[model samples]
Target: MRQLGGTELKRLHRSWRRKDSFRLALLLEDVQSPFNVGSIMRTAAALSVSELFVSGRTAAPGSPKAQKTALGTGRYLTWSTHEDVATAVRAARADGYHVVGLELADEAEPLAAMDLRRDVCLLIGNEDRGLSASALGLCDAVGYVPQTGRVGSLNVAVATGVACYEVRRQAWADAPAVDSGDAE
Candidate 1:
């Protein structure tokens, strides 16, 4: 096959972008940094995550730092801003989504072993204070990315990306197998 030219390559990439579907959503609670929000948007878009829910004073999607960090990802993904985390979680659950929180509480199950399935929403908390009791209580399940090093935690965006990828990976694995009717 002939190699594509620069214009063709651009078109191909655009087609891929156009064909992308948002399967997952990232729910941020009280995340304070615009740069972090932007970074997460970029990662979410790359992962085909459909939407972002920014709650409890998390930086708005239109901020310059977020825009700069997102590197145009904002144009490809949808976002919603909310003042109440529990309300959002309830709304998601009512919509048939299984809510999951990414926090390291005593009750949190390890991310490596968690089951990530359809109709799910992944919740992320603030940079410093972590998730509030009310927010944590709203979730159906909570998961933690195990930490073995000296540092106690990861940046909110990094943790979000890790958790998102884990859910996506598990979803891929759990997909139903297909078979042809004609046998050998």
Candidate 2:
């Protein structure tokens, strides 16, 4: 067995798009590094994020530096900019998304424990600081990625990717099985 070629990879992507039913949104709150933002944008596109909102000086995916990392995948999403996390949170909630903040807060539950099968907006904060007090207050739920490593926290981009994937994973896991007629 050999590695799948580009054609095979493309075929897989095409099939996954058909199962992309979850409504996922992301709110980047003051994630300063352009590279991080770019990487998160790539993950967001792969996981089928329907809405993206950036605020508080988070690097825009369309910026030159970010584009260097995101390539053209960032264009697959339509993201908006907001003044701050509070406003972004309000907007996300108004759009029928249950905003979940990714942080190691005192009250946060394990990320995987949350019911992410529904429409969810993940709020990620700055690289150095996890989330502002006011911003944390704005979240409908707070969740953290349970880690076994010695590291205190994950990189902003990495955490975003993991959380986004978790949301999709939950949805996919809870879905009813379909034969899809692929097997002979």
Candidate 3:
């Protein structure tokens, strides 16, 4: 077994990017920790999310602490911050994305069970508060990552990573195969 070098790593990802057919965006609502913001930014880049909508008190990736943690990965991502969650959700919907809220709220289905479409705008909430009632009302659907551990919820950043990956993994599975002519 061998690990891919930096160039090979790029090639591996390029293959997936070439085959990706769906669009995914993220909306953060009041997730205040810079480390978490930076982590989500990195994850968004890694997963090829088309856009990011940051709302409420979430930290911007350009902030010093966030940039330090993201290592400047946000430069590769397209993001915008809105005055509130509703406006962010509206922006995403205007861009043709299906808004799905990722929260542990009443009536939310399991993440894997959600009927995701080709373009998804995932709405995440504050680490402490989760989604507000009004924010939840803005979603077309709601999903939660089903957990069996002692903890009832996951860290905001970790949950974002998982949700983003799940969204792409579903789209990728249904996308046509494309060979980038590079050895894996």
Candidate 4:
């Protein structure tokens, strides 16, 4: 495959930068590790996430550890700090987003098979505890990244990337097909 030039890549990245667009929001709850927070922020930025809402005792994006891991991506991504996850969920839902929690629950659907529709808000929880009952209750649906390895699950940041990519992939796939109307 051909590689994109620097200008082409910049244009592609800039295509999704809509300040007022409510495409998707990322909800981070009670995440303790700064490195994980930073890594998620980097992924969020690259994916053109509309906003990031961090709640509970999650590490702030301005911290040194976050800066080190995020490598300046946080500077481009818009984020807000919330005191609680419910408030974040409420605000996002009120804005017409379908809140989906990324967790491995008994009833959770696998990411690969999920058909995400409309605008979505991705909820990522603490590493050790996952989503609290109250927080999970607010989700429209729960999703999991299927794994075959002995390790039960993936790190939060890694899992977040997989989930985010799936959402993007599905949305792109469902988009109106383009017809060049020319011979291949």
Tell how far residue 36 is off in model 2, in angstroms: 0.5
Query: 34, model 2: CA deviation in Å?
Result: 0.5
Model 3 gets an lDDT of 0.89
- Per-residue lDDT, model 3, residue 135, is 93
Error of 3 at 6 (Å): 2.1
Residues 1-184, model 1: lDDT tens digits: 7777877766655554443332577788988899999999999888777667778889988899999999988998888777789777766666667789999899999987987766568888999988999999988899999989999999999998999888777765654432322221
Q: Record all residue pairs in model 4 with backbone atoms less than 3 Å apart, i.e. clashing.
A: none
Give lDDT tens digits, candidate 2, residues 1-184.
7676877666666666556577999999999999999999989888888989999989887899988888789879989999988889988989999999999988999988988888999999999998899889998899999999999999999999999989988887766554433432
**Model 3 vs. true fold: TM:** 0.94
RMSD of each: 5.8, 2.1, 1.7, 4.0
Q: Which sequence of candidate numbers ranks them by lDDT, best first?
A: 3, 2, 4, 1
Best of the two (1, 2) by TM-score: 2
Instruction: Highest TM-score: give the candidate number.
Output: 3
Q: Tally clashes: model 1.
A: 0
Compare the candidates by lDDT and give the number of the best one: 3
lDDT of each: 0.81, 0.87, 0.89, 0.84
Q: What digit string (tens of lDDT, one per residue) describes model 3 on residues 20-50?
A: 7789999999989999999998999899989
Worst 10 residues of 2 by lDDT: 175-184
Model 4: residue 179 alpha-carbon error in angstroms: 12
